[model samples]
Target chain A: MTTPLMIEARGVEKWYPNGFQALRGADLSVHQGEVVVIMGPSGSGKSTFIRTFNGLEDFQKGSIVVDGITLSDDVRQIDAIRREVGMVFQQFNLFPHLTVLENVALAPVLVRRRPKAEVQQQALELLDRVGIQHQAHKYPGQLSGGQQQRVAIARSLCMEPRIMLFDEPTSALDPEMVQEVLAVMQELARDGMTMVVVSHEVRFARQVASRVALMADGQVVEVAPPEQFFTAPGHERSRQFLSQIG
Target chain B: MSASPNLSHPQRTASPPRLHRLRRELFASPLDGLITIALVASLAAAATGFLHWATTQARWAVIQANSNLFAIGRYPIEQQWRLWLLVTLLAAATGLSWGLLRAWPRADRRGSAWPPNDTIAAALLTAISFYVPLALHAQAGIQMRWWAITALLLLVRAAAGRWGPLVPRQLRPLLALLWPVLYLIGMVLISGGLGLMPVPPAEWGGLLLTLVEASFAILLCFPLGVLLALGRRSALPLLRWGSVVYIEFIRGAPLITLLFLGQNILGFLLPGGLAPDRVWRAAWVLTFFAAAYVAEAVRSGLAALPPGQLEAARSLGLNLPQSLMHVVLPQALRVALPATVGQFITLLQDTTLLSLIGLLDLLGVARTVMANPAFLGRNAEVYLVLAILFWCCCAALGLGSRALEHRLNPNTVALNTSAHKA
Candidate 1:
């Protein structure tokens, strides 16, 4: 059975003013409930491509349709796209001044103008879902790397986003802590949440991903099912990346 | 001590005795000891001579006699209660506002800072603060009034500490309305026409005029500075250029030149009998000058912020205004605290320049007191008193800003790591 497309991007191109090309004709697509993991060497532009989906990074040339909101120069459209999309950063970019519950509840209450009590209740439930309900009152600094990343995931889930983007969320975690973040993501995928994750976690990609896409030198080099991609990646760059990371 | 755990932290130890450490650090070598002893002897000799002169020789009676003039200038003595009332209101306000922020970071050197909760300590500070005026034999009214303001400040602080942060979102409009409430109060206090005798702006002088000018300038200048900073960072060319031009133009001119223009030239610009008072004129000049420097300081703070703050706020679906209010400015203001506080202190001192235009602020009153034949030949006493007043006010502002900085951001606030993937 074919699933409906949740995201479709075509010929995405971006360049810095200083003349460094960060993305060159990168294309990405995700179907509803698909867990697509993009892996690449550093500077391969996988993170930049993911950021473009929500209009955080402007593209010089591209068409991205996420949840039917096209990325464009229009402010209202971009804001709509951002609301429908939730992003988790590698740094776990939680607001330091606010408590974990506030971090989760802030975007919905402030952006969506939802009822405070309702948003807070939902946030508490999200925290529990992420396995950090006990840390609802604690600030981000008080949490370990794994717990903080989990809180970030819950914060995104609080928005009830149609598409979730993870920009190397576990890249900043301790080796021992990486498993906990991946476990949460695995649970999220099991719930059929459409997610695009840019991470170097090979085991997570192999186990949880619907497809593993390899990017090299600012372009998508190959896209294949996880089992096939892990065993037989098409591109020379993908083989090199796999060997180097191993 | 016998079976300590393998902890990561260093072991604590009792510090060396002060005398032993001092001798080792300062008197280790014979030449070092000889030089240290000589330096100490010279400092003690100078301090003793200064104390002797201060205690007996200086005629502090000049300041004593003109204490009322120093406190409220030429305003009627009976009506001085209005100024005293203003002080009480402002002190209470300071306490309430101070209570809104959370406690200061634990890393502060003085331990727990002077928050509103520390009312007894505030009362003690108030009592101690009055000693300068009391030691010089100021009127009991002025001294008592100072203590009253300080005590009230502490009381309001405690009250605010209890319930200010607890003010629910529905009552936020009440808090928002406070700015207008304060404006109305200030206007009534200064102009005094609501069933009270009107004190002309010309009669406003001494600490009254200094505090009024600096406070209004600080209050008005901060919003203006924030606007200019936002405008300078705005994407629109018109707003950015307008802010840039205004900031550059005001910063180019000396504050004295701006004051001169406010006093001498602004009157010509206004229609006959419609000109604002010199006090208002000086206020405008000070506000404009301060806003420019404050804008620069705030811009530096904005620059210091990592780009991720904006990105994060934007990604969270916050528009520009919401992004700025909820995320960017909160952090930027903490970064801008010291520089903005520095500008405020400078503006306080620069209020002295208002005296050049015949506005009788603290310095102006001191000058007038010196000019009087009765107080002639005692310039030292008047100037010294004025210096002390200015120094105390500036110090208070610096301390307040430092406490606010520690409370708002602390060292843990800035989590903007340059490395995204690491």
Candidate 2:
């Protein structure tokens, strides 16, 4: 009864200017402290759907209400929404000029106008949490892919965001390095943060995510508890995707 | 598929038979050897003549003695120290700026350190300090004020360098603004603001005029260039068009034409009677010319900034102006700084063209002195010194630009290192 529904999306659709409809009508609902994983083949609108939640990508027709704020075309609201929804990209967009500590501290200092001392302390703590505290003074270029991804996570967490979104966070890493980033993510999920992850790492989804949502051709083909979804997917498209990706 | 017997034989590890090859290359034939020898002899003769003229036979001692003649023009011998002090102040400022920017936090131990360019700077400053005092011995007693002014300038520079970091971010912008104030003070002091001191524009000659023209133009034009660049990219159509017209129209013509227009037509254009100061008008015209070029450089800087930077700043909730000053402009101006400095150097060299309009700058003074009966046939000597002075100025600007470019883009250095090793 106390489960708080943090995000609700109904009939989300995106028709880009060039007449490519990247997303079809899709409905999703996520609860507080729940991990949801979205898996799909390439060009299935998995990334596009997640990007819309943070307002990085706007949809043409949809109703998305996150944390009680409704999505609108108003740019101001988009910024406000972005502040609460922390996103980590496949390519860690850490500012090259800034050291790891500075990169983590930037949003807090610039966005929240936090005191420098407080922000620096929080930045270091987040870096420690991500297991890159020792490399705080080094730039993103100096770090390994795994370390950079961890720093990116730390940077997002520095905002103290309400919800975390990971868009193929480990996809760019080498096979050996991918586990380190996934392990950090696994720790975040265990800590009971609300998270929506778009990833192909099926083992990660099976172990952590409460529900697995399978998307195909811009539509959610299946949504079921991971145990049932993987073992007995209802839809033929979901069954085929699992066979291919697994 | 069988190997040939000669090829299958193990190669002997031995030197080939040493042929007594002639040292001469293709010049073995009689006609070629004669032509090569003649060419070598002619080159040697020319080299010897150049060395003798450039070093041994040059009248450097007399030129050194009358250096003030080339440094500051026919200004009263008594006021020569003022010009010397100004040069020393500028040199000290150059040194201080170099030191401040090159200084890094003590924490960065693993980072590569720049070679001590500051020592070269210090040596240059010392040379100026020594030369100024030695050259102005006649007026050294009474012109202690000049030395005091130089010391004050040095103190300001040192203070700015040392305490600059401690100044709040809000005040750092005002740091750039201080140059205009300092320029005004120097101008007033030189133009008889002090009852005891007086030097008119007509008398302001030599390298001092070059400095005056360059520094004044930079102070006036740099800000105008920024405005024009911003205006050209403005959302308002009227502003964009106006700025584009201004920049393009000025750039389309030559500097001499603008100077001529400023001298001849400016009085008629304005209702207020134009000031009778030809040098001021010329400086204004040069500043106008420079602003157009500077605008183009700044526009390129603005264009180079990533669109994400602007979006990020906006999403941080900063207003348009705040985002521009805090985020967009800072990065853009860093990209633009070296180009602006290059333009400043070009403006300095272009100041020599002021001689065409009868202003007695260093080149003007040199031409005047050469035309006199006393210094007849010394055009080569005067022009040689002028060329050396101009070369030094241009070289400093070039080096400074390279250093700044290296700092801004260390990836270039990294790429070069990898290329060199490979």
Candidate 3:
């Protein structure tokens, strides 16, 4: 339990301009190589909470520290934090204009200013790891949804971040194609990559998640290991959530 | 294996013959046939009369006599060689750029055949257009030889296309560098700066002046428009409101008013009665006017993008500029292409407004030519040539933009072909 902390969130709060609160006093911490899964019903702020880790979503109140860099209003700090944290969204937001290889190779070459040849080689290897190396030349639109998601993963992996965040990554995917994306995530987890995933995939949670955090009403309600969380629920809401899903 | 009919070999539904299709479309009902016949008769009658007038009655001597004035305005006759040299350089640069652009690996891989047939056709059409005009009017000796040399320079583009791959990858950036250098050279040659005899902007006229104005306006306004659009969407209120105010204020006024303001009042507005050249003032005014529209066009493009694209870019550690340059603008600009090109064509036509303020642009030159007592009532001939010139330029802009849209959206092209097959 004494591994280095990769992410630390304290009392994170966010509100839309219409005064609807999305994240309220949310707090969580993840150690290096730990896999944390945030699960909740629709509109429970699980997605909102995870998005804050990478500075993709701004919080009106609260502080998030990723890999020792604190997230603030300073763009430079946000950029630095984002450099160490990778995120995957439900929509798979791959750049449709660029080829799959270019998608993976772009950030490293652009943001990191890495040598193109070296970054491309690393990109091709990452694409291979995700089992879409053959689709490297194709645009994102040309690939299957599953393949596009894998390329998105490869694109994130190419940055070689200290932490990875997945916000309902498989929610938009077709049921038949879900397993392929999950398999890549599972492989990623096994490689000891610190990940914070917000998904309803119970099987993925059971298999790879080190801790499952239940969120409701813009806050994290419970955090426990999957074995304990699934078997015996301390909170009444957790039991209610489990039974409803079943 | 069970005996079954192969679905792949299903009977094809052959389309009806072209003649039958045409007959059904045009003559389906008695009313349709009657309407079609009436329309065709009127069109043919009008066209025939127009053709007869154009061939026999139209006096083209005004256009012939004033071709130089139309092309270069009052640009000195001795300094005309500079114009010819500029044309030769332009021809070579355009040819080489086109070749190198087509030779670029990403553009090449998008399945267009090398030396695209349509491009060749466009080139031939352009060549014939230039040839017909010059052959009909240009004084034969030096002008014809310069024409020949310009045509020969254009052939360099084809040769470069054929062998562009042999160009070293490291040296390809020089192709990009060539443009700004050429632009500077053109400025120097035309305006006669840096050790050459200076030509005042007042002396600059005709198509040359119109082109210079339009080019400066278009080039300057694009980046300004992009910045303004970004500013309108900025997180900071000051930047956002400032952009909104500027865009609205400029958009509210008509361009002619802006030009007039530039011509008469702009000099006084400057400190110490410092007046810029009329051409500069007109160009700046046009740039400001066009920029507002371009900003709106680009804003629409920015609006159409999903927020997820920006989020993903930021999540990748790309700063705002990097994200915009690499991801956001490329897609947004593609979406904005048609509208932006439309604005550019409008701006180009808007240059004729320069004539209203005493600048002798293409349209102005035509008016001056018509004013000549020798060519006193050749309005039809003069106006028709002017219309043709404007039409050619606008049509080329439209066609070029479409080609660019196609090249940018390779995925769309692939999807279209697949859809067509389906």
Candidate 4:
């Protein structure tokens, strides 16, 4: 690929204090505009691995470089990396006290020290893009689950992040509401936003992903295009996981 | 199971008659009937006896004669106008706050009705309860005229609620800024600072002293408590440990002992034996003591918040302070509001302990009045008045906190229920 690398991680390792190892030397690299989806069983550490990309989770030993800025123990570097990376969670954790527009506009105004009027205008545009412009003045609690998730997406997009991480973004949605969020993610992918998603939706992976990575026991065991990963299994664990889910 | 006809449309089933409901509740069985009758008889007897005593036996002469002492203990008579001016300022501020609050648009689209019936009723009830006794017993002269003027100012400002929206948007910020300025002005007027005749803290007493001490303590302790709460949760070990130690030490000691120590030992502990006034010492002690409790309250609030909220804020590039100030604390403080206000009320009541340390708060002045040979053996009247005053203040605080909680959480059931009704 001629595109520049957006994220690079080498030998990431994380261990909880209770002696449980969540991640053990996991490595993945994504070029700009590439969509990488990590699929695994519950304990395979897919969530933990992506969380480390934005410095949300601490790793015992690993080096991560995002958008040419290396993630280190330094607070300033962590903050800088966070500013460049945006994350969406399964629960759609919007600030319940603030209006939908305020939730999207808050970080830019507070963290970026941008003018309120400019940020709010941008926030409204993002909300419109997510198809919830009418619900902008309402609090998060007043919105439907799908609407709230879409607002969450708009909130992340307002930062104009170079890399977006999704940790089971649709896993918390109702079965009927999943497609609305998936549709938004698909749109994001088509727009050439670099994305890392951890989800169980094989259809999303098959449709939107540039490459699919399989995780097993705290490590990425296989990385391949969706057609190859789904139709022809390279690893025994991958074959077993597909059969179990099916 | 077959569906009953009433179950299919419960609302269509007419409620049982009130007489039948009453009978079912009070006389379902022989024993129930006897118990109800016995309880009713006892309640009636107690009520009648209290009414008889209140109407005929209780002498309010002591309260009537010492109203000035109760309002502003030992404040020189010449400076009494300053107290009246303070009252007028407070009345106007209260009205303006109420008007502005009502004028602010709610998120739920329900318009704030002007001259809200319940609020007006409450104000009238409070005025009647306090004013009736004073009118019947006390001489109606300068004090009464000042009271009328205070009430007039309050009415005028509250009427401004209807026009609060008409206030220019540019001037609204100034309106918000006016509060702290007014508070400072109040302090200066009370203490006679900035070219006015200075009044010593020793001369401050009665409800005036109690209120001054409580207000200052509440204002100062709230931020201190929030900081201490955050410090307790800090990743830095020193700050966490220091907060833990302070909270524990203060919570471990009794308030009375702290008050005594503040009055006696705090002077020696300060550099160059710089003893502040006794009132100042008492107020500081109350502030520090209440802050420990407030910290615990706020900590509970912080604990109730989901871990995801902080993570979301951080992922948006907010540093710890920005994340906390914008997202975490607003939600946590809302959760902590009831308990924090509870601490404030307790702190206000705790100021009564200042009397024990030689400062004459409301309780202290009451004791002084009871000891006067002219008002000998009027303990019931004196104590009753004091209890009523304290109750009024505490109840007002409770109401204010409830209003604040409603304002902060428009998503709460309180607003939802109103919306449902609408």
Question: How well does candidate 3 match the true structure in TM-score terms?
Answer: 0.93
Name the runs in model 1 displaced over 4 angstroms.
B1-32, B91-183, B264-275, B410-422
Give DockQ: model 4. Answer: 0.80
Best by TM-score: 4
User: For candidate 3, what TM-score does chain B get against the true chain B?
Assistant: 0.88
| lDDT of each residue in B258-307, candidate 3, tens digit only | 99888887777756434477888898899989999999999999999999
Clashes of each: 0, 0, 0, 0
Alpha carbon lDDT at B420, candidate 1: 20
Q: For model 1, report DockQ.
A: 0.37
User: What lDDT score goes with residue B149 in model 3?
Assistant: 64
What are the per-model DockQ values? 0.37, 0.16, 0.74, 0.80
For model 4, residues A68-147, the per-residue Cα lDDT tens digits are 99988889998998888999999999999999999999999888889999999999999988899998888899888999
Looking at model 1, residue B131 earns an lDDT score of: 78
Question: Native-contact fraction for each model?
Answer: 0.48, 0.06, 0.86, 0.82
Candidate 1 pairs with clashing backbones: none
- The regions of model 3 sitting more than 4 angstroms off are B1-20, B105-135, B146-150, B268-275, B413-422
lDDT of 2 at A90: 84
> Which digits, one per residue and each the tens of the lDDT, describe model 2 over residues B299-388?
989998876566544433444575677667866877888888889889999998899999888888888777777666766777877898
Best-to-worst order by DockQ is 4, 3, 1, 2
- Quality class of the docking in candidate 1, CAPRI style: acceptable
Q: How many Å off is the CA of B275 in candidate 2?
A: 9.5
| Model 4 spans with C-alpha error above 4 angstroms | B1-33, B119-130, B133-136, B268-275, B413-422
